[model samples]
Target: MHRVRPLPNYLVQRYHGWKATGYADNKAWYRRLASDGQHPRAMVIACCDSRVNVISIFGADQGEFFIHRNIANLVPPFQPDGDHHGTSAAVEYAVQVLKVSNLMVLGHSGCGGIQGCIDMCKGHAPELEDKGSFVGRWMDILRPRFESVRDIADDKEQAREMEKQAVVTSLQNLMTFPWIEEKVNAGELTLHGLWNDIGEGSLENYSPESGAFHPV
Candidate 1:
């Protein structure tokens, strides 16, 4: 790891502003917002990639969306595990407590995690011999997604297709939550699959009709 770092002047100024957010005149506004309680209308499931900041991209202010992020932006099917599940827990709170009306699975191009999943599925990378290796097992969560789209295309097209399929698969898996499913069926909630092309600053929405992502 790099032992030293340079602080961007822009970030330094932002830090100063954030630090002052709780002082004097700002404190009342903060307290008022907190007292009103968070009632975000949407929940976003996004990747842990630094390039994809959902809040900034959507131009959101505080308490706009309850977000859950993980490697490759995955959403594992609901299951009880002894350990803490940060993403799942956030989802539970977003649905049960926040009562968000919409859920979005957001994916982006040039994702390292998706690339790794592609590699592993093509036999170009090593699989975990056991479930103990954290990262190895983590990517394995997308194994079914990988296999589902394996024969759809070749070369770069294949990779892109895989990434999109992964997003759709995660959105489908999101229904594994009974509360989410119930809400969706009753018209209380909606799920969307979104893909962002970082280089082009363009977005696409998944279309079941065309079985493709359309520019949005």
Candidate 2:
């Protein structure tokens, strides 16, 4: 039998504290959300890094944004093969069902997944190159973008550029989906790419015209 442990005490205590305070203070809003369902205007694809808080950064309340978190904040190409594609599924739901008007891909500095991709591409992370490594396979989505930044002599600069490239790669892949492309062409949906400097608490918006990320 597979063993499943109970919730840790600290987490339980935290949940109780939030239930008593945050939940109690917003009981009516919670109830309304439960009854009315979510009608968020935007969908955000962000990294699974603990430091990257999509809600706090945007000052968004619960249900205000349909957010999807994944390693490196990646969106793979539109592959309709019979396979489990969590990120793609989320995008389909957000676009087809929820009909969100905006879709944003948010990347962050010092992302472990991005670093892992760097190490893997440089042949430094052998474990990640293993056939059984899920992370390695997932990071492949960003592998093609690594070549664009590889010529940078400074390691830190290369990593930073690669992180921003993650956002760009995802944005490009988002358009590969026929529905997303159709909506974008028809002006029903708009796509955005953003990179956040975690330690500095700064955000940059990607501009297609300038082909670069600028401070937001």
Candidate 3:
């Protein structure tokens, strides 16, 4: 509490406005959600990009989705090395405790994190090559996939291609968890990969059968 400070006036004012309008309009629903705890059916693992709005894009109400965001929306492989693993813990809670039926990895266009991975892999970004960089290590999860699109000469499109590959990698990584794999095998859970084009405001769903992404 000692480390905490009052919120900025702009954010405070916005909160008050939301309380007056949005909150007041849905007082009962909000109260119900609080009293009964969230039972979200889906868990959305999305990129920590300002452009990606997980709620607004789905037109989902509060408590509808248990959402987690990370750099490039990546999920590292299951490593129970006893170190703090925030993303894995969230995935465990969502799959084991919350029992979310659907999990989606949402990747977006022009993702800075994905671009950083590309640069680091190509020996372009010296800063990311440093071992002390947490972002550098995180982006390493996507490093192996970079080879798949290395032939693409266009830098922008190559980054976009790797952006979708991030989603593909995450989907594969989720199954590394024993519990998640068990649930998936039993048909209790489903995994999905998605890519978003921010400029076009379009969403594409990955089709494993066709090995392509199609607009929803």
Candidate 4:
């Protein structure tokens, strides 16, 4: 806990700007949000890419969407062991407590984590293959998807396709949680997969019936 420290000068200045402009202008709304506990209708699980702005792209306002950012937006299979589980805890709390009706897994092009997974699986990134590597271990969730795209002949295409697969895989993994599955089975919850092309600035939604992603 003691490892925490104050922000650097650049980030501090940026925070000051946001606090002065955005936060100050919306003080009343922020205060109301603080008074009334958040009741977001949807939960968006997206990548940690700085360019992929889920809230901005959807034009969602504060307190409207519950967002969780993780590497490649991948969800690991439900593990009940007594250990740290940030992603799983967030999903559980959102579904079981917040009662978010919709859960969207958002993936994006040029995902470094997805690329690392591909490289690691193909023996190109030996550094990530180490047993103690957190990123490597977490990315193992998408390792299976690599094999499906391994023969695509183009590295760029393979990475893009695998990025989409991360969303698909996470949706699959989300159901592994008993609470999530129960809510979904009761028709109280819905699952969605989304992908964004950073360069093109286009969004796509996964079609369950067609098993493909279509532009939104």
Candidate 5:
């Protein structure tokens, strides 16, 4: 079956109309970026969920941010064994090449990947175990966290707290890179862990003092 793609006329017309706005002045400026290369101010590691697109969420102009999206918004520890890790590669380019000033790990509520990990940990998830599956291993990235926060709550409503902890874990993993750690210690780059709660259309900042996500 062929997929239905949005008509080119629709996209082209939208772009042409958007070019008239002051906010979209960069639309043409980005046309020059193909030859100039992208030099974004921030690098965002976000989730692959369709509703959680980082570019549209931040309302950033083209080439303004180097973004990487993966299941559950994960950033695995750096490894070198001839394995191609797309997320890590984007991180390297953003930090090493573009030299972005900020690195953000953005998480959202009601993430299917997070829920999958939660279900697997609770022994109720059966979908991933039957086939030649990598879900078990991929979800291992979140295993330690699930164990850490499972004792705090036993219901879906309380799982929001666990999601907050997972963001903290991702921040900790970010510093595993020597360059990132040095930059952070030297105040060259700032690391942020943010949670976007889709349910209430709210944004939360991870507060170290409270050990919870606080609305900004």
Candidate 6:
């Protein structure tokens, strides 16, 4: 509490601007949204990268998407050990309570988290190996997938592939949840894995049938 301070001047100004323009323009809609609970149809698991704008990419408005962001958009396997599982809890709420029909894992190119995982797997990031390092332990979820791309000679290419692997791994992990599995099997929920190329402004979708990603 001692370290807490008022919002910065620039942020305060920006908030005023948005409140004046965007909020004013949609005042009625915003009021209605506040009164009625959200009913988003999709839940997007995305990276914490600032450049990857999930809402802008899909042209989504407020209340349309339930987004959960993490280091590499990784979803750990289901383990009900009574631990603080933020991602798992989000998934559970989205599936069992929110009942979102579509669950999407969105990965991006040039992700620092993916690079950290690669570095960690190659033993180049010793700091991440420390027991108390949260990023190190979190990146462990993607550590096993690094072996698949380790043979690639091109560093840039390897990183790109690893980024997509993060999405794939998360999709696989989502299935580990029995509720998610049941919904998918009953044709009540659909899972999607997508990769966004920030520089090119292009998107790719992972096809389970083709076992590869294709341009969207």
Go through the candidates in order and give the C-alpha RMSD of each one to the true structure: 3.9, 1.0, 1.1, 1.6, 3.4, 0.6
Error of 3 at 87 (Å): 0.4
| Per-candidate local distance difference test | 0.83, 0.96, 0.94, 0.92, 0.79, 0.96
Per-residue accuracy of model 5 over 1-216 as CA lDDT, tens digit each = 478776799887877787777437665665688789888999998888888867766888778988888878887776766898777788888888889999998888888888887888888787754456666666667777876767765576547766676678788878888888898899989988899888677888887787777777
lDDT tens digits, residue span 1-216, model 1: 587887989998987887776355477766777999888989999989999989878998677888888888888778877787787888989988888999999999887788887887777766542457565577777877776677766666777777788788787778888888999999999999999988888899998788789998
Give candidate 2 misplaced runs (Cα > 4 Å).
none
Once fitted onto the true fold, the runs of candidate 3 whose alpha carbons sit more than 4 angstroms away are 1-4
> Which residue runs of candidate 6 sit more than 4 Å off their true CA positions?
none
Per-residue lDDT of model 2, residues 1-216, tens digit only? 479889999999999999999999999999999999999989999999999999999999989899999999999999999899999999999999999999999999988999999999999999999989999999999998888998999988899999999999999999999999999999999999999999999999999999999999
- What clash count goes with each model? 0, 0, 0, 0, 0, 0
Instruction: Sort the candidates on lDDT, descending order.
Output: 2, 6, 3, 4, 1, 5
TM agreement with the true structure for every prediction: 0.84, 0.98, 0.97, 0.94, 0.83, 0.99
Residue pairs in clash, model 4: none
Q: Can you write out model 3's per-residue Cα lDDT over 92-208, one digit (the tens) per residue?
A: 999889999999999999999999999998899999989999999999999999999999999988988999999999999998999999999999999999998998999999999
Candidate 6 residue 98 Cα shift, in angstroms, is 0.7
| Lowest lDDT 10-residue stretch of candidate 5 | 128-137
| Candidate 3 RMSD computed on C-alpha atoms after optimal superposition onto the true structure | 1.1
Instruction: Give the lowest summed-lDDT range of ten residues in model 4.
Output: 141-150
* TM-score, candidate number 1: 0.84
